[model samples]
Target: MKHPKDPSAPGTMRVLDKQPTLQRRSFLRGGGLGAIGITVIPVASLAASKDVAARQSFRHLGAATGRTLVRMARDIYPHDKLADTFYVEAVAPYDAASAKDKGVKKLLADGVKDLDQRARQRCGVPYAEVKTEDERVALLKDIEATPFFKKVQGDLVTGLYNNKKLWPLFGYEGSAWEKGGYVNRGFDDIDWL
Candidate 1:
């Protein structure tokens, strides 16, 4: 078939026969990569996937239950810049110094499990499942009143507070010498130093 723009040349079409020269010039300048381009897709997809993966990774929060604990940590340790860093490290499976002391690791796990179960039994739902802020606060109070809760809270406090990352958050003014120095914390008598 012969086209009007290229009638003299049988079956040959002018690449930019009917288009405006400006549009043609712009298209040619793009090096045939299409007007809007292609390299943007994978980068966008990867960013989205990374966000989803990060959310999914923290699905199991043990006894802490829901993002509320994270919020609580923020409130309790507001000044701690390494709160998240220490928290993630703390929430992971425990790794103590000795192999036989693995029992202590189990004890900590059991303590958290017991606390969560207590919350569920008292409230008819897991602590994480509670919707209202009042309910969460009330649940914490109930836990505090119990011996088991005291024990668990003690262990958790010990574990979490011992974290080097939490020292500054708790106002522990220790030297940052890693582990050997006078941590002259002035929480006691202000005049006593």
Candidate 2:
């Protein structure tokens, strides 16, 4: 029962021997789940802990900071037809940047605090908790010229609309290269004239 690679063990199984083989897709999927605060448990324990994944919470940024980023992304790219998930995805780069750069992290933290302070001064509440849209808009107007706002806005412009998952929803067929360069796949379908 000893692993051939190990010389010390005679009858005991190695740690790798007890683990199941992992596929690349499954591994990436697990990582994605982890990023969103979902725990990937063994399939054997899945039935018993179906609710565990639902209860787990993961936040790349602080809860308040994340909320503010989401709201800001939505404002910058206002699409009433799009779901909140789109806005969340749009702000993911900011979260990632904050994680990698100390300056970015400080910028986000300070920006969120400043926004909350402005909201408190104007509406007696935190920015994320502000009830009136007009008040939130006014608060955003005050900070729109700041470097943090401009950075997030610049990131949102490309990150929000350039996502491949959103292309189909917006009637974008996404690069006809795979279909023979769209030579016969509606490339010349336009006949409005």
Candidate 3:
């Protein structure tokens, strides 16, 4: 009478079987670590979990819009050596500003929509989903003069590149105060006049 899924089980583990409920007291008595509950779920469920996490992560922008912003930011900065994570970090303040200001939110939404529409006209795809970098660059160029683009560029100029976490990536040693100021550090490293 072993279970089909679990050979050691004494019965069949049917799909319709009711999952056991755990009581707090019983859970505590069971040495929780030893009686850890495990459940098998469909891949779709895992995807949904990721979707939920993504939704929570971006407060102001939707996934598609956020993606478009990331691309635009990368284009403006053109830091091919840096990872996408830096771009995401750079755009976080924009997202926060959008969350706090309705006008900013509308501007971002409209900007994203405008970019997508441009992409559609050029390549029949959304801006965020555009496959070719050339097309993306073309689309961005079309909107480069817009206030939306300028705002994004201005915000990212300082926000993205100024991050302390990213300083070391570009050979920046950060503040000189930590190691007893620039006098002791390599402030005078310039030897070749």
Candidate 4:
């Protein structure tokens, strides 16, 4: 289309620019093929699985015992971003130890029973069934002096803190030794502080 008054050129683009180029730009422009619009979908989501149920098995501890330990682990750590599966994974070490050591098995079983009794007395439900976090925490506080409480707390520290996979969730980028230490890196780059 050309204007009646101005007859500079009919086409909007210049002839040299509009014309197809040679091998220099051919590879970049994909010759004549152009870029295909390909949408990629993965077989499964890579993000943390929230709804995935943890399959727990314990030789010495009962099903209720494992469930109670999971709840207790969360009550202690209390990370909102973390899932129940993580708590399950954390408390699983206790179950493994209990299988090998009868003393550990007894300690867990008796402690759980005692805590459940306290919950029943206070809220008319077992410890695992306790509705309020405040009340459950109160129950844990009451037993804080006990060996079982100390043992479980120690187990959780190992299970949670030592995990490399959980490092990213807590904003930890692992030890700085491998990356030539945090001094050279953005050691003070933290904006939240």
Tens-place lDDT digits, model 1, residues 1-193: 5556774777665564675433321222212211211122234434444322124343333324323344333222222233243443443333332124655545544544655676677777665555654565555555555553454344445545577654554556656456544444333446644
Error of 1 at 170 (Å): 4.5
- Each prediction's TM-score against the native? 0.37, 0.61, 0.64, 0.70
Cα lDDT tens digits for candidate 2, 1-193:
6666675677555564557454332223112211112223345543554333223222556766877777766555554345566567777666677778889888888988988888899899888778866677677778888987777767765787688876765666889888789878988888874
| Shift in Å, residue 45, candidate 1 | 22
Number of clashing pairs per prediction, in order: 0, 0, 0, 0
lDDT of 3: 0.68
lDDT of 4 by residue, 1-193 (tens): 5674443755444434466443321122111211111123232432444333235775469788888888877676665446666677788777778878899899999999999999999999998889988898788888988898888877777787677776666666888999899998889898987
For candidate 1, the lDDT comes to 0.42
Best-performing candidate as measured by lDDT = 4
Computed on alpha carbons, the lDDT of every model, listed in order, comes to 0.42, 0.64, 0.68, 0.70
TM-score, model 3 to reference: 0.64
Q: Cα RMSDs of all predictions?
A: 24.0, 21.3, 21.2, 19.0
Give the winner by TM-score: 2 or 4.
4
Candidate 4 structure lDDT: 0.70
Q: In candidate 1, where is summed lDDT lowest over 10 consecutive residues?
A: 30-39
Candidate number that wins on lDDT, 1 or 4: 4
